[model samples]
Every structure is written in C-alpha cells, then in structure tokens.
Target: MQDTLHGDSQATGSGQEEGGESPAMDPRLIAEVRQAAAGDRAAFESLIGRYQGEIFRMVYYRTLSRMDAEDITQDVFIKAFRGVETIRDPVMFKPWLYRIALNAVNDFYRKKRLRSIFTLFSGDREEGQAPEEDRASERLERKEFWGWLGKFLTRLSAAEKEVFRLKYLDDLGIREIAEVLGKNESTVKTHLYRAVDKFRCEKELCGFLKEEKP
Candidate 1:
C-alpha cells in the first residue's frame, strides 16, 4: 500500500509510470500463483504470506472492527484457496482476491443485517451522532478521513460510492474495478466520473484529502 501500484501496468491496462517504466509481474510471484492454482500447498502458503496483511487491512477498513475483519479475512482466503484454479490469468490474482474479499464482506453484512457498508462510525453509535470527543482519539485519527467521507458519500448512489472507494481508497484502477465488480469499463467510468464530480464539489473535504493523501 505504498505509493506504488500493486499489479503490472500493462496487464491492468494502465499507462506506464514516469521515467518510462512499465512494471511487469514478478516471475516468482507468478510462479507461486500458478502453483497454488495447481494445488501446491507450499506455494499457496507463500501467496498467503505475501497478501495476508493487505487483505486484513482491506477488511479492517470496511468492517472497522478487528475481530470481524480477522474472521472475514480468514474466510476470504479459505474461499480463495478452494477456488484458485478458477482464476484463468496469473496477472489477475490481486483483483480476483479482492473480488472474493468484497463478496465476503457483503455476505457478512447481509447475515448481520446491519447498516449499509457505507456507514463510517463503528460500535453501538447511531448514524449521524457525533462521537464523544474523548473516545478513542487515536483510532478516530486513523479513520478520520472516512468520517468526513461518509457525509459526502451519503448523497451518491450505491454504484457511485463503491466506484469511488475502489478507485481512491482501495487503489484499484478502472479496469481492475470493472473486473472486480463484473461491470464494463465504460460503466465503471461513468460511476467514477459522477462520484468524482460530487467529491470535487466538497471543497473542504477535497482540501483535507489533498493534505492527507499519501
């Protein structure tokens, strides 16, 4: 989750980076993905080692609960392990894994019958209630962006909200997002553009994001 993009630029249909660099998939990782798909236990374990933290963080960002995130992260990998061979292209391992995580999160919410995934505040707090000033300031600081973000996102349609999160927070490019959401690139772009238009109108949030963006 550094500034660097995760997958190969060309395979993802993104442009080359500065200095004319077009990063390719690492051969060793590609081998691991293929081996895991072919039922190599060690290779699958290696893949788990590389992605576990990222998967956990992604789940944590959505769930906002360590316990739920951990459970969902485990379930996501379990499902992935069972279905790895279904992934036809090695270049798509990251997005394929992400798709699994997204479904797992949705299923979690569906069973719980909780608030929409768009809700930002955690715990027993009611939506639209201001959190007590002294409550878990450190954790709030970490998630502060989302607190501000949830306000703007409330006005967006479901498709727009998701497209925005995938593009900006999840750091998936448009093509990868389309693959994950089972949508066409043009559809993804339309949603993303509408979301961006809404986001640009929120001057305070836009300025805050500019200052906070990594």
Candidate 2:
C-alpha cells in the first residue's frame, strides 16, 4: 500500500495542465476535507456523499463483484475518516482518496490469494462449478459489457492496465494518475500509450476506440 502512495509533491495538481478531463475538486469539497480533518462528522459524511458512487464504480470495475465493491467502498471512507489529517494538501483530495482506494483493492487481492491457498490446503474448493452471479437480470446488458471489458483488460500488463483504467475509465488526467499510482508522468504516459496500442489490435475494442474518437 505504501508503494501506491509514494510520489513527490510535483506530481500533484488539479486543472487543465494536469490533463484531467474531469474538473478539479470543488472549492466546497476542499473546505469539507479541511473540516473533516478537524474532526467534524457532518463534514466527513458530506464528503462521503459526494464521492461514494465514483468510489464504488472504481472498485466494481476492478473486482467485478457487487458485494466486494460495496464492502471495500465502505472501508475506504472509514480509512479516510481516520487518516484525513495526514493529507498535506486539501486540493489534492481526490487523488489522495483514490490512493487509499487503490490500497484497499490491493489488500482485497492479498486476502483473496490467502483464501485460495487455504482452500487448496483444505481440499474444500468447489470444482467445475460457476460462481453465483449476484447481478440482477435487469442489469444484464451492463454486466455483459463489463465481462467483455474485463477480458480485454487482461491483455494489458499490470502497469498498462492501471494507467488505462485511471486515464479512461476513471477520467483522471496524466498528472493525477501519476500521483495516484506513485509514478512519474513519463512512466504513466508510456503505459497509457502501450495500452492504447494493444487495444487497437483487438477487433472487439476497435469500435469502442472509433466511438471515442473526437
């Protein structure tokens, strides 16, 4: 988790120069973070209300499990409430919060790996059985799209995958992504370029690329 939070202050920014399509954090959000850090419960809850959906979507894209995403999203806010004071710049709140989220996702994968090991040792695994689908039939179209996207993502290297998701799915700018992933801007761009080249080779994603063209 520390590895995901190790960038220098030079990587932090929140405007056009950052390459972020999304607007910078609202001035109101900056004030809310400051108040929350001062131990105001309402301020912290307001912060949660402001970003919960985006955080949940980030987790869901990575985990593809509704229950796991919800659980992790709650954990993220709890962790943030406890550690908000550690944040040096209130304007960097979104990237800092995303760093916490990325850490939570990493922890989830670690625990899942441990569970797999335990299941192997105990011979308790259910073989040749599909995992139960938790999504509703009404959301089948969305689920199918994510299913295909997940497969496409696997084709990217881990670094490329992270960059691609942050830049495209999360709508983060180059500098914001650099801060969140603790990478330099050049390294982030390299990964994004490679990921795009790989995506161009996939027939299924070609239409997506075309549709996204400006």
Candidate 3:
C-alpha cells in the first residue's frame, strides 16, 4: 500500500470503515449483521449482500485474482455466517468479519504456495508456461509493486508471511496484528522488519529485470 512498485490503485476503506453505516451498503445491513448474530439465516444472506464486494476487493487486490478471491469470499461468508451467532456483540462484527476475510486470504495464499512449489519441482512448468494471449488476460496479476512483493512473501517462512500480510496488507497496527497472530508486538515488528528487508532486496532485483530490455 504505502510502497507501490508501480501504478497505484487507491485503497479505499472497508465498508464498515465508513463508520455507522456505509452509503455503499443498505441500511438494513446493520440489522442483518445483528440478525445473523442471532442465527437468522435470511438475515445473514442479507448481510452478505452488503459487504461481499468489499471483502472480495480486498482479497482480489492482495491476491491479484478474481476467481480465487471469489471462492475465498464465499468461504469467508460461510465462516462468518456460522460464527456470527456466537459473537457476543454486534458492534464488534466489522473487525470480526474482516478477520474472516483475512483468514480466507491466508488460506488462498497457502494453496498458491503449494501450487508454486509443485510447479517448481515438476519440470512441467516449461510445457505449461502462459501463452502470450494469456499474459495479456492476466496482466492485472502483475501490479508491479505487489507482484514483486508477493515473490518475497512466498520466500518468507509461513510465520513471517502471516505476520507481514497483517501489518502491510491489512494495515492492522502492530499490536492488533500481534493479537491476531498470537505474538508479542515486538515479535510482530521483527517480522515486519524482515519482510521489509526482503521486499527491498526484491525491488532491487526488479531493476535488473527491467534492464533486460526484452
């Protein structure tokens, strides 16, 4: 977000970030969120109607995907809808909802990391490399800054990537990230430091990539 590898797309606030009802969402959504908390399926569906797009956008931007994000968004809602009934306070649902969304992103990344690892070991990657036309179709998959940043993320140990994604992509304060991640704030900061160091090194590599001149 703060560190753009190239063209920047503004990171708008999440729906709840609008505070006390988002214009982008129906006012009924507040009722629905509360209802879902009370085990109302119909109300939960209505809640999904309101903020699904926002959650999807967050996932898609960070994951650089639509299909994957779409699947994960549904997963987020299903988890939320089920857990909503157990949540004690409706007011706290916003962050609770986001935590679900974040988990979806993490799961998506884990699956991707596995795919990449498999591809690396299979030698079949050469036969399956993207065709030229496919490259154009998938171009948004290459937000220059994020594309580079993601490579570094993949290189990180699982704990480090989990910690870093919360700090940077989710923009959670270090303390908040520490709570979600079950680490000391100082430990979280160390992950952020390591992640940044890795990102800077990778950005340097991109300069070399650009120098290739086709």
Candidate 4:
C-alpha cells in the first residue's frame, strides 16, 4: 500500500491546481449517477470510473492492506449498484456513496472480529505473521506506520475512532460526519475533541497533529 498519510491532502486535491480552488463535480457525473440509480448499466460504470480512486483510497486508509482495500472497494460499489435507486436526491450522491463505503468498512471489521472469536475458540494461530527479518525491512514502512497508528487508535473508544477517521482520514466536516454516522453535530464534536486530546498527549503523534492542524 502507498504511504497514504502524507498524500491525503494531495489525493483530496487530485485534479485541482495550486491555488486551492476546486472545480465543481461535473454535471455530467451527476446525470450519470442519476442514470445509474435508474438502472442504466453503462451509466453505473461511468460513475465507478469517476469515483473509484477516491473510494479505493478511503478503504485503503482504513484497511492498511492494498488487497483488502481493493476487495472492499469493489464490494462498496456492488452495494451501491444494488441500492442506488433507493437514493432520493441525486445532488447527495457523493455523501451517499461515502456512507456506503463507511458501512462496508464497518462490516469488514465486524466480520474480522467474528473470525477472531472463532479462531480463539478453535485454538488456531492467526495467519500472516511476518518473519522477523521481513518485519525489519524498509518494504514494511507503510505497515509500520499503520502499526504506530493502531497504537494511537487503541486508546480511543469505538465512537471516537469512527468520528476521527471520518473527520481526518475521509475529510468529512462535522455536519457531514454526523449524517454519515447517524449522530448529531454536537456528539460528533465531542468525540472529535476527545480523540484529538488523546492524540495531543501522545508525543509520537503530536507532530502529526501539528501537520494536520487538527
């Protein structure tokens, strides 16, 4: 997987220029989303082409595994294709798509948790433990960064983790995050602040917070 932490802002600004002005989503894209919602297969493929990179990045940030992220990204779109017609407002497509992506990530972890429980009961060792030599290699740099991140996240409650990821990793604002998480804005703010305070106390992550200005 790519070192997504440093490239987040750039990925968010992918097609935009140096002045920070973002062009509006193409009207054609909106039309395509609506058409896809109405069961147009070709339109749905167009929508996938438009948003796949962004959705893949979002999943990759959460999973920290390129292969898992790719699989989950495909799953997200599959769900969207099945449920698109249920969407009421075409203007809300981006957020709606993101909501699906968030749910897919949550479901992925839920399944993983269940598997862990089953593994424990069966007395099975976990798969994919890297060799000590491989663990020390520079090839694992991104994985090591995720390990550091996992340590910081372990201090937060589940709610805090959801809010923090939506705010920082997915780049959603307070209102948007509240809508996605089905919480009120004040609740989202509370979780975000608590999460930030925890991060602020960690010397290893303090510089990261400064860079993010969060």
Candidate 5:
C-alpha cells in the first residue's frame, strides 16, 4: 500500500492485497483508474460516475442537509480529480475520497459554526410545528439522544471523535478507518471502545439501542 501511493509504476499495476487482486476493487475499474491517473479524461469520468451516489450519501449522512451535502459532494470530486496524483494508493481511493468529503464537512462547519446533527433534532421547533417526518415522539427521542451524544462526544478527544464517527456511524472497519485517518488499528479499536462506552451509558439512547434489531 505504501509503495502504491508513491509512484506511477505502483499506481499502474494491479492492486494485490494478501497475495491476490484486491477484494476491494473490480479489475476493470482498477484499469480505468490507472488510465485516468495517466491523463485519461474518460477514465476519470468513469471513476467519478462510479462513486457519485455513494459519495453523496456519505456526505449527506454526515451533514444531514441536501443543499450542503450536494455542495460538498461536488467539492469532493473536484478535489479528488485535481489532486489524484497526491493519492498514494489508488486502490484505497474510495476511503480516500471519503476522507476528503469528511474534511470538507469539518471545514464547512468550522466556517459556518453550525452543528448540522443538532439541526436533526430542532427540525421545526423555531417555527413551532415539526416537519411531518419529525413527529412529537420522534422529536423527543432525537433531542434526548442528541443531548446525550453532545455530552458524550465532548468527553472524547479530537482523534476519538473522528475515529468513532468513521467506525460507528460510517460503519467502516478498523483497517479502512486506519487508512482514512492515518492511525493504527489498535488505536482505532481503543477509541471505538471509549466512544461506545459513552454511547451505551447515554440514558435515552441506551434503551433505543437495546430495542434496536441486531
């Protein structure tokens, strides 16, 4: 993986993990990426076409807003294209792209000083009538869980927030998350444990999790 991220020879070859073609990529798509990295416009477009929907969903799940998510999604691809050469391991491109999307989200929040996740709870409280999608019981539940998460997440350090968000909400495995955050697997596990402990202790959310299907 380290070799792949560094040069054209590495990028142009098939990605082999554990002595074979990577389970993470289709061989054809890998070829297209290699071509694109060599200045093939159509190949690059193919890459973008393949990833757009998944990337948009990733952005939306984090931002919880269509408008901002759309904006950030576009930004992510543009950045990916403009900086494709900066990507060391083309095989891990999806996770790499997600990392960019996540960074764009963080930057957006820093600039706007807004917390979109909290917006999920407020829904229409300022207007006094919640959106139909967010009824009273649901509103109460979301607010309660969110309030708990605030205190819980706040207890975490910065790296813990990124690791927990990626591992839990994003459902990324430890190695994938390690690649994304540039951390080791054990560190990722430790953070996940700490974050989950807080999550389980959250008064309202604990019951919801207990009731949730496995």
Candidate 6:
C-alpha cells in the first residue's frame, strides 16, 4: 500500500515510458474476472482481495480521509460486482475497476460541493497506532511528497491532472488511462504531454527529485 502510494513522481513527466498499450493480463486473473462476472461470489471476493489495498490507497490519495476512502472502496467493489457482467473484455477489468473508482471519487467531491462544504477530508490516522521505526522516515517523506504534488496538481487542467495522476502516480499505462477516462490514446497522450511539460519546469520539484535519486 505504501509502495503504491509512494509511486515514482519522476515517472509522471517521463514521456511514453508506459507504452501505448496495456500490458497483457495474467490468464488466471482474467479467468477470475470472467467467473466473477458470471455471478460467482467467491470469485468476486477474490477480485476484491487482489485489488482492495491499491484501491484503498488510491481513494485515500484523492479524499485524504481514511474513513471516506474505506467507504468508497467498499462502494467501488459493490458497484463493480453489480456491473461486472457488462464488461466485454475480461482483460479490461483493471481499468474498468479504476473507471468506477475515478467516478466514485468525482461523485464524492460533487456531493460535497453540492452541500456547500468548504472543508475537505480530515486525513487523520487511527489513534494509538504508530508506524514501525524502519518505515517512519519513509512515510513522512512520502507524505511530504504528496503534499507538494497536490499543490502542483492545482496548476493543471482537470484533464491534464487526472492523466498525470493515473499515469505516474497510479502507474497506469496509456491505454489503461484512456480506458479509465473514456478518452482515446492520442488524447491521453496529449494531456500527459502538457502535464509533463509543466512538471519539468517546476524547479523546486525537480530539485527534490534529484535528492530522491538513489
């Protein structure tokens, strides 16, 4: 989960690294998606286990609220379960799931805006639990990175920001991002190109990336 959350920020602006196509799906995972789509409860639960951690992390990154992330994660699976049979290509299950998640996050924000709420998520961790000593520093650094990245994302258009996050932060391939966003490959690339162009010019973030190099 931490690894997913702390994805390579430098990768965001590195053009075409993920290739134009999605990587081939594992046959077994494809089978699982197919079975789940056929109403097999166990298969659906298996899908949940496989993706829940990353889904939770993705949601947490967007909402910054542990509770909201948990609820949305559950809702994502519920919605997926209900609609799995509509999926034409089992190989597309991953991106399809992400599409659901991205929609759910957008809906979350929309509802908040509708209610005229100015304050966002609390982002608090559970009380009385401490991170392991070995991971503490890494967690703090990643937290700081997210804070900076969040600020930077505000400069991008909605399309550019979403493309950048899905590509670099969430490690989606271009085809997968297109599938998730309902855009074409070229459009995805265009948004990514614009985002990366801006990202490269961010001097402070570039300096931080240099320090982050191994």
Please, what are the lDDT tens digits per residue for candidate 3 over residues 1-214? 2222342334433323311222343456667777788788888877787667667766766656556677888898888877888877555565577777877787877887788888888855632224432553455544454556666778898777876665555555565555566578778778778877786677554685676446
How do the residues 69-106 of candidate 5 rate in per-residue lDDT, one tens digit apiece? 77999999989898776655567776788789888988
Off by over 4 Å in 2: 1-22, 123-140, 208-214
lDDT of predicted model 5: 0.67
Alpha carbon lDDT at 29, candidate 2: 85
> Which portions of model 4 miss their true places by more than 4 Å?
1-10, 13-26, 121-136, 208-214
Per-residue lDDT value at 34 in model 3: 72
Worst 10 residues of 4 by lDDT: 13-22
Tens digit of per-residue lDDT, candidate 4, span 76-95: 99999999998777766777
Point out the higher-scoring one by lDDT: 5 or 6.
6
Local error of candidate 2 at 35, Å?
Answer: 1.1
What lDDT does each candidate get?
0.75, 0.78, 0.65, 0.76, 0.67, 0.81
lDDT of 5 at 55: 71
- Checking candidate 2 for backbone clashes, the offending pairs are none
lDDT tens readout by residue for model 1, 22-66: 246799999999999999989999999988877776786676666
Please provide TM-scores, in order, for all candidate models, with all chains considered together.
0.75, 0.80, 0.57, 0.76, 0.65, 0.80
Per-residue lDDT of 114 in model 3: 81
The parts of candidate 3 lying over 4 Å away from their true place are: 1-35, 40-50, 61-63, 90-95, 102-146, 200-214
**Candidate 2 structure quality by residue, lDDT tens digits, 68-157:** 888999999999999987877887788888999999999999998888898998988743222335323345645556666888999999
